[model samples]
Target: MNGDVHVDLKTDSRYAGRLQYSCSNKICTLRITDLRESDSAEYKFRFITNQPGGRFTGSPGVTLSVRGLQVQVRRSSVSYWATLMCYSSCHLPDHSSYVWYKNGQKIQRETFSSYSGNFYYPDSYSCAVKGLEGFPSPSVCGHGHSCNRVTYTDRSICAVKGSSVNISCIYNSYDTDIRSKFWFSPERSLQWQNPSQPEDLSEDSQYAGRVQVLETERGRSTLRITDLRESDSAEYHFKFTAGSFEWRSSLPGTTLTVTDPDLQVQVIRSTDYTYNQAELLCHSSCRLPDHSSYIWFKNGQKIQTETSSSYSDYFDSADSYSCALKGLEGFPSPSVCVYGQTCNRVTYTDRSICAFKGSSVDISCTYNSYYTDIRSKFWFSPERSLQWQNPSQPEDLSEDSQYAGRVQVLETERGRSTLRITDLRESDSAEYHFKFTAGSFEWRSSLPGTTLTVTDPDLQVQVIRSTVYKNYTEAELLCHSSCRLPDRPSYVWFKNGQKMESVETSSYKDQFYPRDIISCALKGHEDFPSPSVCEFNRLFQRRYNTN
Candidate 1:
């Protein structure tokens, strides 16, 4: 049967004239010819005897794997030699010898499936079985090189901070005498340079003593970076100089994303309160290596029996759970309360916020307690805490002199609280955390909380596009902001300090002259407007003007 659908041996065109079956003295045989890769499947034989209820089907099925030979390339660790192997889906006979070809010419006869040699660029290699010389593997260039191109081994990689990563690539050039080669990140280059020069990663002070370049193979290079930081996240490109010519493709190169090593326990399956059991999986932004063990924590204590990444256990409503990597126990995940109530926990509604200057924002969160009576609660910013105060004591935001009359904490709901801040200043940009005390226990403030960023509200009119027509000049203007505004607020456009009616969007397009001045403001805050800019700026007009 083909996946649940029966295949007729006599009428099915796919198997017609190719399949044969015969039975003699209770011995059965089946045969097929010209097997295709699609024919690979688990096949079972069924038969029926003359007696009633004698129909019998095989308990297990035979698995068939039809595959063609592929040329796989592997490089030596200490030398420039590489091994080209004739690989297939199924294992070949141990006694069989293989034939190798270099540039379509017969090269050697090997007893094994692989051939080792000092392979170099511009040389192509293939392999085939000794008897089946006509079915040769597809030719693969040495070191994965093709003429004058650089191919990255991986397009993107995500790694945790403080971990090491290796970015590799294989490059080939028409001129084999390479003079210089190195890796660089365009994102980290200086913007002031007219033609941005690629700075070698090894020379960058930021990567000093932490970067190394390896060129053990003929055309392969690897950039190893250790003690990674989140700021190191960027696109990495390889560059090489062959004679006077330099090669650096304009296309995007391998992107390396360095994330924090924080772990989180994700709920795979949650049961009702009656069952009080759930399946939880430890997760991280960057994937951990295979077979990495995990450590589970319940109510601030480690659970010794659980070592796998996932755990299933009965939990009480007051119990909170967390996880961490076995070796990196210093950075454990924030504890998550089960059932979302009756636990000493605080969950912020939003993790980050961006607000305009002189505006107001509401940072809210839901808090819970295992005890009925509450002792005290307040909001604070650890970053702005006074050093003179007691290190263990958290000062309330309401009592802070900087936010004397601008901050208010409102607890309108039984379990919800919102902190509203008015007249936002740039100094207000800091992480805001909520804390509450129930009896003798206080919610953990080490867990990540909402971060607020107060940015300048002034908008700038940027020239997105410009067209120089025979009769007039048409340009598209965009009201740009340094920080994203909340709620997708509508924008008000102004021409020479006069509000432009009928156009309330963030963008405007029309025939513009050199004297036209354009600006923008938020819909409700029209009193504060962006600085007017000339329509035909020298930089923009120079880009489109045809002298």
Candidate 2:
């Protein structure tokens, strides 16, 4: 149907016997009994209908195309159970029967006289036929530069005691749920044994009480495994049967690795001080905690005994210790350690300085220890030098409108604290400052600010082609942006100059590798398509959010 074609049939005969005629409705029917000698240019059907006046002659042709075993996967490194859809289309009024096969071996599953379908199973999938003729080699969504090639995020890592892990095999097959899908191991038989059990088959074979399909909401699914055990590591396979079509499994193996959440504290530094008289003070730190606490340690251990501090020895007459040992000051320099380990690692790592209007860079900071609890971590770009503007507040120093969306911290968890920034324009770069507070102890920063270069976030746009015969898929434009987020930046996905959103005020964000990489993928499916990521100023304004 993509192009135009002209076809015709002709034959001459004078004296002939009564010719046979066969056709259901107004269509012509051609019958061939021989298989080996049936190699011809076309299959022609002649129709001669007797009318009241005379007889009319009409004929038609059906092209015969023979297909072979051909299956493809978008990514060569995808996990097992990933979807592998097999399909083929042709011009036909009605099909009598349909069948499928693998390596020439007949496949026994669901059959479809209709052409296209999918397989959620893992393995090789292909098709054969009975009444229909001509087939083509199948192709899959393989890996390459195109985004449509199905790049995966390696979310296959599952936790031992966690809930079912979702493995979304997303790709528009434009078919129904019944289509066969391949779910299997590429190297070995993919299987999952209970994480809480032994590796012997004496319990249960293939997946013996271990693997389960993750639930689907809004039509997305993932393969899940619970009670993660060491032996529950293996590839799984899924093969599909759709009419005469079969496709092989191209998904990578799904393995189950056991991981447990654990953390411990180890004191790396401790010192007793007695700068002057009756007060005894000490300082100590450990592997530290991110965004959690600021508890002080005393007498070789956590301050498991005291609560408040009152005084400190002369202490160099420079830096003052909070709530020191008042009465103990005279009893020799008593131990008074103030711990500062609760800085959010994900939000306060790589502390850096931002750039000015004409030239600037992003600030960074991270906290990965297991000490004190983190309070609030923030950044100051060149303090009073660089130009500033916040979308919410005014750009004034003390309470100036300095930063808005650009100032951010990673969503706090039990283990990390860090920050990232993006969309760095010239005025948006410079010495970015870092300030973190854990419990009662506060840590401002290290020396000057972290410098950022706003030359341009590595950005580019491109197009993608599809191997599947033109279906109901849309032409999508891909936008790629690469930048190291020093501060947590609100990635504003923009389509043209306007933003892509359900609400003008609500902001959307997802987390990736903290501190190192952050990406914003907004589908560009409209005309005049141009996608971009914008990180607004935070100090100058208030972050806009629905929450």
Candidate 3:
């Protein structure tokens, strides 16, 4: 079409490398490697015979469509089971047998049509034809959907403010004609039954741009809310409508409790480092459930991994300590310093490092050890550890799936070690510490491991005005990150493109008036501040007047 021959099956430079053709018994077969979507076309094969005028072309050329397989999930008639079908627009051979996989592992051999089994999660399934087993279809999860009902994976969850939480459930509809799916908290007095109300909570200004509804195969819907606040603590429900029939489920719905992190340090003065002497316990103001586990920190460094509510370690009165729930390390308690510990022996160059996503961070620490020959030197972070490991058990954090390719242990000198992480993800935000083994003695540095905060920063604002009490009206603007960051992060606030002085704290309190445009961002990351949240005096007037 562009003054060039397009169909050069034999000599085309691009196709020459992969295209192959064989002619035998008057049948010509053409094969190409790594087919592209643009390869869809019809090609007629002309045959030439030894006899005069024996050349002829096939009347109807074969049409080839190159496309990937997509797996469609259906609820089986049998309860708790799902049927996965792999589909391709190009008609497959009649004799094709299907191969099935569960969580990327082959589960079934040559079988007919589809695969059926008791599906469980966190396992997902996909299917492929016998010959193209290498390129399996996209995975579809066994979403725990019951017959025409909605089921939650967990009935209750706890989240930290400024962190994200996901509320998920599996739903089913026998009608097959799904019109809509949504998540909402009836506590807000917003119900789908109200025709005027938006079907999804994301449409509400309060939750817009902050809530995400993710759907997987077999009707699994997960509502992920970022920058959670105290007001977010509530029971959440899911609803879906099929044709004319609709169902909203609140029975045993997911209840989320959001809390702020508070760390209290208790130190006993003693000379020796032991559980009984000069011991430190990281405490929380509010006790979690008995079954919940605890993580301990010395200064800012993690020191204990006991699952109990409190962590006790041989920390001197001079050392600083903190604590947090095991799974909720993102919301670590504030560090409290004792009279003093020898934190001077080994300390991080920077107490905390905040960098943008995809950026690299270097966490360096200087140390003083009596022993000279360091046998084993390594670096690890709370993000990589599920439980605390004593010096006796040294795990290769480099081998961890999360840090495998992203971490590097660097030692520039005898007394200094640097932990370099690349391509930072939100999960990489954690306190990294250095460990060394010197001839029969093992040491894990404490007090302060370099805390890294990897953020694709976003700002969020919450208006907290108590109409019932009529006490006060104030808007609290906060710089929010997807992950929990240092509670004391300095913030910069702006009003109508003008910087506001003394607005350094994360949450800015202001008596906002109508038509006031305010925004906030992290100290250094002021470029992408929060979208302006304007307050309307009319709404505030109505709210206060009612109460």
Pairwise lDDT winner, candidates 1 and 2: 1
Q: lDDT score of model 2? A: 0.34
Sort the candidates on lDDT, descending order.
1, 3, 2
Top-lDDT structure, candidate number:
1
How accurate locally is residue 311 in candidate 1, as Cα lDDT from 0 to 100? 89
Where in model 1 is the C-alpha error above 4 Å?
Answer: 1-146, 160-165, 179-217, 223-252, 258-262, 266-283, 287-317, 321-334, 338-342, 372-377, 380-405, 410-414, 426-431, 458-484, 492-547
lDDT of 1 by residue, 435-506 (tens): 777777766555457889998775777877666455456888898776667677898998877888988888
Error of 3 at 102 (Å): 34
* CA RMSD of each candidate after superposition: 15.8, 32.0, 27.0
Q: What is candidate 3's lDDT per residue for 1-547, written digit by digit as tens? A: 1274123354333342346678899677888765656677787776544444555677698888788677777776776688777788878888888887654456646376766666654455667778776455655567643334565655566665666888998776656888888888866652233422435678767776789988866679999998887888888878877767666532336778777644454553444324434445554433233455677765355755565644444545444556677666765655555544333245567767787777677788776444567687777665555543654354666767777688887877877888888888888877777776666756654444678888776567554432212443455555566544545678888877789997788667766665567788877667768887764343454555432
Tens digit of per-residue lDDT, candidate 2, span 1-547:
1143122221111101112335677655543321221233455543322333233333555666533334444332344323333343434335434455433344556355332333333223444344332331332332221111111223134332232343345322322343544344432311113221223222245445755554354333355545454444544333433444443333332334443211112221213323222242222111111222223322222343443322222333212122112221211121222334322222323433422222223234443323356665555555444455543222322243444455455545544434455444565555555555566645442233345545433434332221111222122323444444224333334443555564221133322111112123323213322233221211011122211
Clashing pairs in 3: 299-320, 300-447, 318-340, 318-341, 319-340, 319-341
CA lDDT, every model vs. true structure: 0.74, 0.34, 0.64
